[model samples]
Target chain A: MKLLVVRHAIAADPVEGQRDSARPLTSAGKRKFEGVVRGLKRLDVKLDLLLHSPLLRAVETADLMNALVEGETRVTSLLARAPSKALIEALDEPSVALVGHEPYVSELVAWLVTGERQLARGFPFKKGGVAWLEGEPVPGQMTLASMLTPAQLRAIGRKK
Target chain B: MRPAHRELEPASDAVEVDCSAVRIALQEHVARARDAEDSRAVHGLRVACARLDVFLRLGRRRALRDDLRWLRRSASNLRDLDVLLESSAAGELDAQTVSSLSTERTAARAAFLEVLASERCEALLDALANVPSVSAQRARAPLERLAERVRRRGEQLLDAPAEFERHHALRRALRRLRYAREWLGMDCTAIRALQDSLGALNDALVRETWISRVERPASSALASATSDSSSLVQSLSAGALHAWRATRREILELPA
Candidate 1:
């Protein structure tokens, strides 16, 4: 199974800055995310399942990716959190792209790949960075394949 | 040995104090054995192995890991032979059941029982007499490690930048936020409601994308079809145009 973990694009501040979940994507964030869609297409990555966090910004991000890819996208609360045994059991995809926020992505990566309690580090994915993992679905079997920032993506696109 | 409570520590440190790798290996072996046969004994063995694995992963801090280890191994051996016998009997019965002969079914049952006796199912039972009560403490370490990883990740998401292009960061943040709530063991009513609303909005966008890309083209094709048909077709096209204008008005009036 291959898991593509993506961070959502920049978003506007929520009304009165109520909570993180209430935030919306900024205009710049949208354009940059569209660029990400282009980058994924250029890479020729075929997604089987696209799962998003049930946050407005995350949902918007998933929508953009779903538009780019040829599959169904689901907004799952399971993808909204770090690794839960329940979430792991609930997953029924061979290849999945998750659109969510940080720390949890890093944490989930660490947990699934190492079976150890440690945080993932050294991948400074900006507002539109992607981290891809490829390996067995079993715990402690996956390995990181690539981490790309939006700037890196644009650079690659320009190079092509 | 009596169980002893200890302060929480890293898995590495705990392993050094009491090796859990051995127990994990044994549990794996038992599970593999169970998978090889389909029988009551195998089911029991699988359950026992699962329990041992859970015990080693979630048990209380003070429990004796070595005692738990010994009990698991003993149980594995007993369950292995019992599973083999039951599986042999069940397989024969399944074959007999498929055939339409009462005598063959009876003979199959008798042969299965004979094989069970020869397999020394009683000897396995005798060995089980000395099995000890394995505490559930052995299972705590893995669960603790998993929980810690989730909590740290949740904290990271909470502190991460909200705007990111790849959407992975935002997704991770949302997951961690939800995981944090789970870790805190709070009620899920508010979280569920928020999740539902977000899901609905996402579905709406997906539908909109599909309509714009696919349904609109089809609709336009349908509209053009009337240009070559009867006068009634022209009237139908006019009605369709009027309906489109009305639909646009309704959409414009909708709350943003």
Candidate 2:
């Protein structure tokens, strides 16, 4: 099983009239994240499941991701600040791609890889970054196959 | 405005496809890491380079080993500088020392870019796009070879002297072994923990060396600063030593 976790792309700053969850991905964010999907497609990553937090930006990111890979994209409240238990429960798939927020996404990666509740020091999950874990979906059963920054994805995507 | 997403076509079924992809990843990561100079990028570049090195070495392509070595060397001083600067920013080192280190980092960055542009590096990157006839049977050879090499290195580290240089070498060994285990998709938490301890020890030793080499002021403030820094380094080194010993023992006692 492979779990590909992605943080939501660059989002609009909090507006006076809008909630944080409603902030949409900025134009630049959409363009950069498209490159990420392109990179994944180039790698022949076939997602068996695609999930996203119910937040607008996460759903939008998942929708973009859905067009690149073969999978059903569905909104799930479980991915929004999901607890470790809920995160583990969501991992029951041959290959899953989860689009979510920062700190939480990085924390989830740490928990999945090291079985530690907190992220190992200095491990950052930048916006639009993606981490690939290969192993069983259970806690600590996975090994981080790869992690890529958005810049890296753009570079790879630009190659022939 | 957003551009249309690039359509992803199906990749070739060749086994080399995976290797080629990994190569692209290595190149992309190393290039991106060069500009960041952060701890995470430095670590990522090292791991990416290691993965490619293991894969290439397994394929008996020694030609690129020199290029990989150069890449690692280019990143080494910068990494250590970053570690030192992190603590220096907290007022451990004087402004003069911090400025000197930052200036050195700029030179290091330039040198790294020069190497990245070298013909050898360009050729290496170009060659990585092609993995000749990596069959299913041959695929397992690298993992087995890496595992054996890691085991041998572990034994060497256990018997090696406890000198600073030896421990540094051990740190490298642990990193290689851990990266190989990761390449093989094996659980590497224990090895990673040990590597972390070894890294901390290395950082402390680097700090001590830097302080000892750099000239300090002849004032009471300098005395107080030196005392504080020395104790911090001593404690850090000791804790790391203890962790290394404990982890090593656990490794040795594991089922063979």
Candidate 3:
């Protein structure tokens, strides 16, 4: 099974009195991430389902990925919290793309690979970056197949 | 605007908490419990809810904490009072003490009935009816930790048989271990004796508390309930202490 963990792309600066969850992906963030999605398509990456946080930014990111990759997109509160066993258990699909916020996305990847949710020591999953994982969705039990930066993913998308 | 009832499903790997057996049991019990005076129905409801709680906790799925907790609390007080009422009848209490308990039981039934008829209770039942997708994998981490926990509680009780708090704590922990094993379709006979002992001991403890709080006419059923409950407390405690040691030994002997 392939687990694709993604950090939400760049978002507009917060406006006064705006809930963090309500923040939207910036126009540039959407345009750039489209290339990343196309890169996923270029590699023939497909999803059984795309899961995203209920927040606006993650939702928008998920929508973009779903457009390119053509999978069912569903909002899951599991991605809204710290990476938990519940989130891992929910990844039953053969391929799932989870769009979530920063450290949480990184921590889920680390937890999957190392059984420990250590953030500072592992691959710094930059905005729109992704790590493809393989194995049972158990903590410290998965093999990291690849970790791709947004630029790398986009370049893969741009290849003739 | 968003859909009127938009809610995302649980994570992809996990199935929802609606086991068919449990759901049927809950719906059947809920129907019977609506009568307000049916103690058997209330008892059935509590047992069903407890089974669901064990499954959810052991499965480590964070789906229904608040609703389950509410349902448990709703069923328990009325359940406790009903037990005391039954004990009162069997103990041959005087007419006045029985009347007092009956009055209290009546009020409890009314309150419980009101809760059962609430929108929240309806939601819980609706939630329970959700069918689960089959997934074959046992979550071993929580079970391993719980096994360690039950063993620790057993040891604490073994070390000090007279500790009131330890008896209560072990009683609670043992129930979790038993139901959790049953949920996973694993054998639970290993801890049944300890569970029975703890069950009797806790019943005595609860009966004693109720007897103290209620009216006790001399030579009446309430007094007899008191004496019956009191006489068994020491023996039940001793029996549980032995069972604790036995169960703890059994747990330790299993391949860790």
Q: DockQ scores for all the models shown?
A: 0.01, 0.01, 0.02
The candidate, 1 or 2, that scores higher on TM-score is 2
Off by over 4 Å in 2: A1-160, B1-17, B20-22, B33-43, B132-161, B214-245, B248-256
Of candidates 3 and 2, the better by DockQ: 3
- CAPRI band for model 2: incorrect
Please report the candidate that would top lDDT against the real structure. Answer: 3
* Tens digits of lDDT, candidate 1, A67-158: 44455555455556676776555456777787777777776767777775374664445677888888875567778888888887766655
Name the lDDT of candidate 2. Answer: 0.66
Model 3 Cα displacement at A75 (Å)?
18
Per-residue C-alpha lDDT of model 2 across residues A53-95, encoded as one tens digit per residue: 7566775677568655564444455567644686667667788
Model 3, C-alpha of A104: deviation from truth (Å): 27
Q: On lDDT, who's better, 1 or 2?
A: 2
TM-score of each: 0.38, 0.49, 0.56
The C-alpha lDDT values of all candidates are: 0.48, 0.66, 0.72
Predicted candidate 3 versus true structure: per-residue lDDT over B191-239, tens digit per residue = 7777788888888888777657676556655555567677789889988
TM-score of 3: 0.56
Work out candidate 1's RMSD over C-alphas.
25.4
Candidate order by TM-score, decreasing, is: 3, 2, 1
Chain B of candidate 3 vs. true chain B, TM: 0.83
